[model samples]
Target: MEFKFTAEEEKFRVELREFLTKELPDGWTGGGEEEGDDWDFELEMRKKLADKGWLTMAWPEEYGGSGASHMMQLVFAEEMAYQRAPGRDQFGTKMLAPTLMIHGTEEQKREYLPPIARGEVQWCQGYSEPESGSDLASLQTRAVEDGDDFVVNGTKIWTSNAHHADHVMVLTRTDPDAPKHRGISFLLADMKQPGVEVRPIINMANNHSFNMVVFDDVRVPKRNLVGELNRGWYVGATLLDFERSGVEYSAGTKRTLEELIQFCKDNSRNGRRLIDDPKISRKLADLTVKTEISRLISYQIAWMQSAGLVPNKESSMGKSFGTELQQAVARAGMEILGLYGQLEPDSKHSPLQGRIEQSYMMSVSATIAAGTSEIQRNIIATRGLGLPR
Candidate 1:
């Protein structure tokens, strides 16, 4: 289990890093919990990746993919996050691309994959409803069959990036009589159609990254259905597995922690550097250990993927460890900065352009978004430890 990259992989990482440096705009850093505005900055970054044949790098070559090794893809993610490149819009690339590759027909692949790869269109996930968050199986969004379309009527809350997305991959109750999971169908809907409305939800950071999307008898083409009828749960699970794959965030979190430490040493408050404090030092040490552990777990998941093994337990371990470690690092950052951490970026005297303040606020959401900390624990207990529910 030596996790060192091969010479070729090292070279690949450097090349991608250089490309990102040259292409990413001067002020464009990847959006995190605290990156102030949406501005579709990631769409432009994604297009750069697409132009370099880096977007959809893991997909098979026939469908606009380089078909690079899975480990290479993981390395790319690490480098991108390390550089603070715009956080990827997972709805299109991470979640839907894999689903379409697996469950979509040849026609669907030809039609959908290229635009997504090119960043010509954006997408959002429409999974959670007002009533369904962790208990997603209870979603009540319904889609009834019509002559050649499905008339959809439902509301999806916390639809990340829906305000900017060109389309959404939604889960709807296509068969109410069946068991909750079995009755659902995975479908795609055009966001610009007659009945779609997206309302922004302001987070604690006063940003509109998440939205509530309302569908008022929206008409979706029947061809948009993915996988078999009444089998959306399986399709959705595959996408979630993709979401939980690899622990790329560990390296980036470690890097950010290093930067925070440097900031503490350089900044003096009441004539004492924050790094001199015993509590801050101990917290950093703990976070360092946790971050390294997360990195190892992620590498294990990457290795399993290379061997064509399903990364059920390892994925859960990586995501759980990586996210928890990030939250810990963010907490430690706030402790080091003390009062200055409260200043917003717009203030004239804020430290690090208010980066730390934003990190603290956004970190609170990290444990809740994607999946909650509680849900991750449940997943690990049930799947990794083989515990009965």
Candidate 2:
């Protein structure tokens, strides 16, 4: 695979960097409280990206996208990550839209894709339940067919951004007796409906990005069902593939490493610079190597998509390695900063604006989210290596 970027791609990156430098709000460090407090700002920023056709640029023109190449999409994602931009919607723009393009009806695409591309709607995923965290197929959320609609009754836990979302793409069991995986169906439900409820789940970081979403006798039209009935397992699997494959983790790590390197160069310990310390320098070097590997994996996935290859185990490999690298880098930064790293961003003496501390807290969830590291290992062992389950 060609690893070098074309001149056009490099030019696009430069333009994107310039745009971010000029357009991003002053004093916006791309870090903030994760709740309704930043909704307005996020919406405003997202609209700007949408207007530029940067959001969903990799999608087809029929779906209101620019039909940009995969390399361009990678460049855009990297730039957004580096700049800490708040435009990309993981659910609507990244995961759901691509799945819809492949499995959804034409009407579904027409109704859903434009709003997402225009940044007029936001979506949350309703996959994991209280009982079905990693063993997702064992989900008990039922959607019984009644008249022209399906009556949904169950709860989804650890649902990210449900409180701020306009819609939710839910995984429900449409057939009870057919077996664990075959009985599922994917349904798109309106979050504003009467039967839908969202309660915040504050993590150890004190971040309120996650929520518990409950559906009580929620009536969803049969038309909202995605792909074939009792075949949501396949669609959900594909969504996970999209979720796992992305440049965000690697790009974000690269930015953090850059900041940390500068911090080490500027700061001193004992009588010399932190970067001059062999231990700190060696750790940073190791992290740089891992970060580069993560970037290569991300590029490989982009190349696979461009070549029309479905990434199964490769996505798992990337997600597993990338998340682990994020955690390691965050830990190393905190260790390098010592006492100052433990302080919050608001503290006057905090180093790197306490980003390392914040990342340390957030990193705990990286391995658990979008399928855990354990699950990813299982996929690699069984699917990639063809090992016996």
User: lDDT value for candidate 1?
Assistant: 0.80
CA lDDT scores, all candidates in order:
0.80, 0.91
lDDT by residue (tens digit), candidate 2, 1-389: 55789998999899888888887778656755243447787888789989999898888898889888888989999888877877778799879998998899999999999999998999999999989998999999999999999999999999999988999999999999999999999999999999999998988877888999999999999999999999999999999999999888899999889999999999898989999999999999999999999999999999998887778899999999999999999999989999889999889899988788889998998999899999999999999999999
Best by lDDT: 2
TM-score of each: 0.93, 0.97
Give the TM-score (vs. native) of candidate 2.
0.97
Residue-pair clashes per prediction, in order, are 2, 0
lDDT of 1 at 168: 93
lDDT of 1 by residue, 133-175 (tens): 8889899999999999999999999887788888999999999
lDDT of 2 at 171: 98
Q: How accurate locally is residue 297 in candidate 1, as Cα lDDT from 0 to 100?
A: 81
